[model samples]
Target: MRLKNCHNFKDFRKLAESRLPGPIFNYIDGGADDEVTYRNNTSCFDKCDLIPNVLRGVESVDMSVTVMGQKLDLPVYCSPTALQRLFHHKGERAVAAASEKYGTMFGVSSLGTVAMEEIREKHKNPQVFQFYFHKDRGLNRAMLERAKAAGVEVLMLTVDSITGGNRERDLRTGFSIPMQLTLGGMMQFAMKPMWGINYVTHEKFRLPQLESHVDMSGGATSIGRYFTEMLDPTMNWDDVAELAEFWDGEFCLKGIMSGADAKLAADAGCTGVILSNHGGRQLDGSSTAFNQLTEVVEAAGDRLDVMMDGGVQRGTQVLKALSLGAKAVGLGRYYLFPLAAAGQAGVERALGQMRAEIERDMKLMGVTSLDQLTRSNLRFR
Candidate 1:
């Protein structure tokens, strides 16, 4: 299907599947263990229904929201994921340009293919740096300093991924930094020769963010090794609190779930906390972000800007999260699959479809602005 005909998240996913190699596609699409969290992330939204108000005049809609000191024209922002160039040659550049065009924030992963400095220099919109606490304290500090120097608007430390999740799909498909394809995986790549050609023709795969600190250029270090060997599992609130004080601007924690944790984020000087399960990439059966939103919002909503992600697919889903108290929602695989399908054009098309869906849903709900939504406007089924 053409980009214009792409109706929902699954449509863009199909487009990406048709365009990319099976192994590479699964790396982005698959989640840990039985993938229970992955399936439920979006499905949990079905449990809640919107009770619309009819009399309100809905002539003009204003979906703009300011979260963590960044003003987003839309209520949804792109969450950072690693290995973008593997999905599309344009990589983070494609995502940055598309997010800027939509006037939203875009995150750059610590493992992003494009350099943070390059994205900062090119895009005028807000940029977030998704960081990981490393075993080497000096390295972690240096990375933060680099991001600070790049003038990133937010510093999001991902706390859930101290160790890599058990992604069985990767083992079966042989997905890695420098792919070591099994026989089955090689056959899958052969089916998509264009992806292989484009991958080779483009600049060789490199994690520009980690280039200075890590020896990723040598191809000896695998992603699994980086997480298992480098990331510090002993990371605690005190450590992050100190980092927050050090960052000193728009600091947020990215993997928060419980009300207690949310409150801790607020107390630790975090401006915001994202209720996420790392796209279900870590801790497979952990509660979906939507399922735990209400409690977390109640705990820290007044003190901190609360945002959520995982399973957001429709405009109504975005509306539902906002109604429940999320200042904004986040998109992970939503834009990634589109980027894999057709680079910048694909992501732009996906964003356009999402915008239309949100606008149409708002008009149907008889609301002119996002703030008009509240928990009372929803009924749980």
Candidate 2:
């Protein structure tokens, strides 16, 4: 019911559901068409079992991992999501601060409500600029240059989402930027007066990430248009390679789901590849990232730091991904729901719980450090 009561992902989700309006909650909860991929993202983890070797005299646990040249205290980082301010007034501010406290990396989306520069100035942790290849080549170059100037440590280009997925939940609820809410959607907002009050009472809502380049006023651009009209559907390895060369730092691909593509990412000079399906928000019935981690790791793990983000709900799940050779994992809704339930406090609690879970699970698994995990520590069902 409250922040303190929120002990895990499901707890945070429950709290978020209680606090947020119907349309807003569904936006975070829903995925592509039937959401089968979204459900499987977590369910796939069930097929893989963690074979812990107990009684190894494990006392203190070290769960640190280095990915994309950033050393993270925990193996999990907050995967970027858009419209955080709408979920909680603190927006990306809370997420940035919490991730810093945990000594891990956190990403800020191109559609993030807060500016990357502002977050950069506040925290010393490695920050990611989640880039989207746009139709305007100049805009793309400018955005990359801007992040370069701001000193972002990593460039995570989301390759899968050339266009937005078919999210039917938004259609039913009428959730949009300026809120062309249907009668039912308006009523849902009316019921959550506290959220509205907090929203209005705090800073005015605006996507500082894209306000300068994109005109969002007068209902000109919603997420739908931003994807269909603005993003470049012609994006390819050449484009990604050029961007990686331009960055000339730690560059990662976020939507790669196949081993061949992971190999191409390595050949393209990418430092890392994250097996993700856009949290099942883009493509439905796609293979879960967890299911594809082994193939990817086998194909490109030697050359590129292979990571994944999907359907991870517990510390054991994180361990499972690591056992399969994921350099790290990214957390999306696991942190967003808590951000919605509370503000910085909520995020901090969620990260704290995750750290504790990882540590506890590591000790229980009879491992003192992350290197102790291996494919030998797993049994596939």
What are the lDDT figures for the candidates, one per model? 0.90, 0.90
lDDT of 2 by residue, 274-340 (tens): 9999889998989999889889999995799999998788999999999989999999999999999
Candidate 2 regions with alpha-carbon error over 4 angstroms: 219-225
Q: What is the TM-score of each candidate against the true structure?
A: 0.97, 0.97
Question: Highest lDDT among the candidates is held by which one?
Answer: 1
How many residue pairs clash in all the candidates, one count each? 2, 2
Candidate 1 residue runs with Cα over 4 Å from true position: 220-224
Query: In the order shown, what is each candidate's alpha-carbon RMSD?
Result: 1.2, 1.3
